[model samples]
Target: MAEKIYAGVKVQVDQEGYLIDTNQWTKEIAKEIAKEEGFELTETHFAIIKFIREKVAKGEALTLRSIGKSGATDIKGFYQLFPGAPLKKATKCAGVPKPSSCI
Candidate 1:
């Protein structure tokens, strides 16, 4: 874990830049992270981010198929939204830890 400032708030993040303490997450922090990753978050993006965060809080496995099933968006749409590595980007923007399924 490493300390960093996001949205003017100090928080802990992992080596991959995912938030280590989910409690420190805020919409402003999500915006900062997404912007840093070259993504401009939209309402659709926020929906996906919230969905991923909820699933993670429940200890559910994070995966493309799982996100697709979330009804926030289909798998194909997810790919379109996040491009190359949708899951990785989504998790980061959601202020969740990097999914073990990633990397």
Candidate 2:
């Protein structure tokens, strides 16, 4: 694990840079992560982030197809919101472990 400080909080990250401890996540941290990825969290982005976090907390599997059906956003819309690797980037912004389906 590697450590990163965001919004004055230290977080443990995995080899792929996803947060290891979801509890350390905060909205400020999410904003910082999104900014570093050249993205700004709009309402749509926040909805997706919230949806991903909820699903992760439930120990559910995440996938592009599932996210599309999640009603948060359609598959095509998800691509528009998160251009490349929507699930991966969104999960990272949500401060959760990378979904197994991501890689």
Candidate 3:
């Protein structure tokens, strides 16, 4: 049988950033993202991820073409701030709600 991975079960790094084993993410990632966004981890961040998750559930692609300004390029700037963040993963963690096509 294949190993099972949760929808949001990826690891989160400190300010240095972390790798995304799978497309999914984790709450720790969310908290790290909040710190990068200049905000403390809170319910709002969770809400944002839920909203993104809902969009993904609705068949929307997580691509820049679909999400607008949040295109892959957007993460380049964020990467600079965070240093080693997996751009797309970090975006997802940050509650940016990536379109299905972003990756």
The number of the candidate with the highest lDDT is: 1
Question: Each prediction's Cα lDDT score?
Answer: 0.89, 0.87, 0.46
Q: What is the lDDT of candidate 1?
A: 0.89
lDDT for each residue of candidate 2 in 11-97, tens digit (9 for 90 to 100): 889988899989989999999988888788888888888889998899988888888878889998888887788888899999998
Candidate 1 off by > 4 Å: none
Task: Write down the lDDT that model 3 would get.
Answer: 0.46
Assess every candidate by TM-score. Answer: 0.92, 0.91, 0.39
Candidate 1 collision pairs: none
The TM-score between candidate 2 and the true structure equals 0.91
Worst 10 residues of 2 by lDDT: 94-103
Candidate 3, after superposition: displacement of residue 25 in Å? Answer: 1.1
Comparing candidate 1 with candidate 2, which one achieves the higher TM-score?
Answer: 1
Off by over 4 Å in 3: 1-23, 61-91, 94-103
What are the per-residue Cα lDDT tens digits for candidate 1 across 1-103? 7898988999989888989889899999999988888888888899999999999999988888888888889998998888788999999999888788842
Residue 6 of model 2, lDDT score: 88
